[model samples]
Target chain A: MLSVNVRLFGTLSRTFEDYHHSCGLDIAIASRGDIHDLLVHLDLIGESIGMVFMDDKQVNNTTKLNDNARIKIFQPIFGG
Target chain B: MNIVRVDMNARKITREIFEPAFTGMGGRGLTSFFINREVPPGCDPLGPDNKLVFAPGFFSGSTLVNTSRFSIGAKSPMTRGIKESNVGGTVAADMARTGISAIIVEGRPNNGQSFILKVDQKGDVTLHDADQYWGKRTYDLVASIKEFYGNKISITCIGPAGEQQLSAASIQATDRDGRPCRAAGRGGLGAVMGSKGLKALIIEKSATNAEPIQDLEGFKASAKIFAKAVMDDEFSAEILPELGSAVLVEPINAAGAFPTRNAREGQFEDADKISGEALAQIIKSRGGKPNHKGCSGCIINCSNEYVDEKGEFITSSLEYETIWSMGGMIGNNDLDSIARLDRLCDDIGLDTMSTGVAVAVAMDAGYKEFGDAKAAIEMVEDVARGTAFGKILGHGPEMVGKHFNHDRVPVVKGQSIAAYDPRAIQGMAVTYSTSPMGADHTAGWVVDSNLEAFGGTLDPFSAQGQVENSRNTQIHMAMVDTVGICDFAQTGFGAPDGLENVCKMIAAKSGKPFCEADWKSTGKMIIQTELEFNKNAGFTKEQDRLPRMFYEEPLPPHNKVVVIQDDDMDSTFAF
Candidate 1:
């Protein structure tokens, strides 16, 4: 099993009432789990995800996760 | 459609049929084309020779959703170049419904007096002596106008900043609620209006005369499809309506492009406190209105009414760019202070983006410490008071930078750059450097296409596809602005057959064929005209480059500097 840290931003964070923005959430997943598997575990499937970053680099749902990986998820954003 | 020409010097108003050559033109297309042909490129922007034009989008008065956009054009006193500052308010629809295509204000008043132009329900134009409103701020002036001229009208006016002919002055327009919070807020066009001795333009909201559409049924069908698509898109339908444009704060910060402390840093430690999530949460807690509609026929409702802790109204809409300018750019994190600053800028008739960045530049130069919200507020208030330092701040970042001898000022052609940092997003570097409108993010918002998570094809830090992406996006955005489509609602164009549906609507209204190809060409024509004016006005490829800071200093987190070559920037307009 691999432990991944996840941080949600914008409206996505509001879904988890007790979610800490700075501290993020820690979850253990299978060693071969990708972003899709991680989203499923977090119950974020079908959510309007704007961008996702793993260790500071943007990643898609199909990208595989590694041990101690840090993930940040955001709602779709439009600029002014 | 008719054009109303007001000669300020003669105090004469005349109505004539719009030029036959501009049959299908509207908004920026009409404004740019007119300014290019009539105004000399080298003419002083604040002199008698300059003209201020107001034009609504073709779909403004039609039964289309989210089309209340208008273009206010003039030679910029700041950039010294052609400018079409687009704004959204009830005035666009009201003006269009009066069957007036454009209102052109020409020449300066010989008597050095101020006046207001009133357009009645019958579309008759008249000029009135407005000496009483000469130095009033926008909020007070708007209330006075409503008290005197009834509440059922839309007003576009300038405040003390414009009256002073400040380079960062903006023309404030009334929103759906009769609040003059919407602004044609760039290029210092309000200074042009003030120089012409025009204080305000009042249009009767009761006017119901709309231009005839050739195929009403077909237009309505396409309109419905476009509206549905806007309602269906995730960014337009859900996130924006829930969080407003402030939703960009977190994602952009995460991308290492939030631009903090006058672009000295890429990220602000306190960014989350001022982000969309926090903004919406605070509004909800304070009993303010979220999901507020700011413009006519807008279904996205991305605007919000910000209130004090006691639940009293402070500002109509606290936007993302203002949040950054007053927040991270100046190294401040208090949302309440930012909201108040937004109201102050709106009241003073100044561009919040420019005003904030000017203060940022001042803070960077050690005039005041960064994160000093009190000092920032005082500086903005000084612009209204016309204090000596206030005069310097009102002219925007370049002037402020010069005043303090600051070398890190992030600007292009006198105008301050927006929220996105070009170092982190190299595509934006190309757009910021090449766009006729200097450092304007909206001129070509290539942020989405540069991020992989947004299904972007290019790398954000690489220069490989940056120039081409910016060029295509800039051309498309030109057409979008000409059509007066709200940038947030442009997601409708992404739906299957959405672009074609828009074309069909155009054809139905103009009784002419319009396709994707024509869209590109029309956009290209508008850019070419603007470029020609700038070229003649003595702008060269050298003026298109970003400041030395962007290329020399590497932004943190990503630790990347701008890598786009100068030759690549010059190639953007190579049709």
Candidate 2:
């Protein structure tokens, strides 16, 4: 199993309110899957998440995450 | 609507018709136009020659959501360049209701004959003596004014810091609750207001009519669709209320771009303690008002009324920048202390970003230890009390660095950069160096552009392709500020149909041919004019470079440095 650290921000992690401080989780993904697949596996809707960062750089659905890659998800936040 | 000209040197008030060139313009468009045309280049920003122009946005007086924002423009005493700062509050709404295109305050008062100018509902303007209110805290001053002139009026005034003509002073404006909270908080415009010796601008709430719309029905249709888009967006409706812009804390920290300890590091060890979710949890536990609107027509309500653990209000709209500035950037994890610092900045009328960054620089110079909340709060007290030490800090980060002989100052064009660190966000590096407004986050926010999922397709760690990212986003933000709506309301404006809806509103309001493409073009024009003004004011492409420290030091955990090349930055405005 391949593992990735996922962190959701803004409304993207609202459902996990109980885990506010620990919204970041280490989850397993299939070797054949990408970020979209990982989102689906985690029961998260992709459209609700605005920007996706992999190890502090932006990533796309097709960007393959190797084992233990870090992912940060944020709602399309605009205000400063 | 006409222009009201108040001559402070002459102590005369005269109403003048706006020139044909400026008739339909408002917000940044109007403010920049007036400033670029009227004020001579290279004049002292605090001298008698500089004129302060205040103009409400085109849609401000209407029933539009998030349109209650106005622009204040002058040559910056801080940056010594053209500056336009916009704020959200009832002032814009009330000022628009006063039936004025812009209010131009020119000339300096002689003989210390200071007065508060009142623009009443019936278009009557009067100047009243304001001697007794000098040197008062902004909240108390506002309360006393509200009590005297009814609780409904909106006011814009500077505090004792401004009265002292400190470069970091900000012009405070009243929010709906009569708190002198919202601020046009950049470029030391408050010092400009102080130089004029005009104590306050009281805008009486009197207009009951909506702004005249050419295509009223069409505007209504577009507005309804846009409002629904805003209200229905998950970010605006859910996260904004739940956490506010402070939501960026966790994600930015996780990404190692949150600007910890005055940009020395990209991440904070105590990030979770100051995260928006943590703040929201605290507010909830303390029964503090969470998810409040900062302005009259704001739909997102990204602002909040932060309170102490005793459930007393501390500050309104304690923003992400403030949180990072006083929290992560200064190494302070105490949210209550940060809240107190926020209140201190607001009440004393100082730019929170500049104040926080200056204090951080002082800490770097061994003035105090990092993470000392007591020391940080005391520095603010020094500013409010106008101490000799406070005078040095009040000059902003550049001066603070100079005073302490520290070389690692984080600033661009004498203005301190905001929360987002350039080492992690290369697009932001371009913005920090190139923005005519000097390192402002709102001038060009491109965190999304670095994400390929949103069409960025650029590597954020290097100099490659970040110029176009910063340029496009900067132009877009120029249009956003020109339109005078809250930046969070871009949820509506960012959607596929958002531009069409916005164009319809502008066309209906201005009775002109407005289209989606005009946003970029008009935005480009405003930026070009500002750049030209800055050039004439003696700014070189050299000043458009980030501090040496940014490029010299590698920020962890990414361990990247500022790599955006110089030629690309110069081409940002080449068009």
Model 2 alpha-carbon drift over 4 Å, by segment: A1-8, A16-38, A50-73, B20-24, B209-211, B453-455
Per-chain TM-score of candidate 1, chain B: 0.99
Summarize candidate 1's per-residue lDDT along B1-575 as a digit string, tens digits: 68999999999899888654533578998888888888999999999888999999978888888889989999899889999998998999999999998998899998889999999998989999999999999999999999999999999999988999999999999999999999899989989998988999999996978788999999999999999999988788888888899988889998999999999899898998998888988999899997799999999999999999999999979999999999999999999999999999999999999999999999999999999999999999999999999999999999998888888888898888999999999999988888888888999999988887776789999999999899999998888888888999898887688888888888889888888788888889999999998998999999999999999999998899999998888999976
- Assess candidate 1 and give its lDDT: 0.90
What's the TM for chain B in candidate 2? 0.98
Worst 10 residues of 1 chain B by lDDT: B16-25
Error of 1 at B262 (Å): 0.6
Every candidate's DockQ is 0.59, 0.43
Candidate 1 pairs with clashing backbones: none
Best by DockQ: 1
lDDT of each: 0.90, 0.84
Candidate 2, which CAPRI tier? acceptable
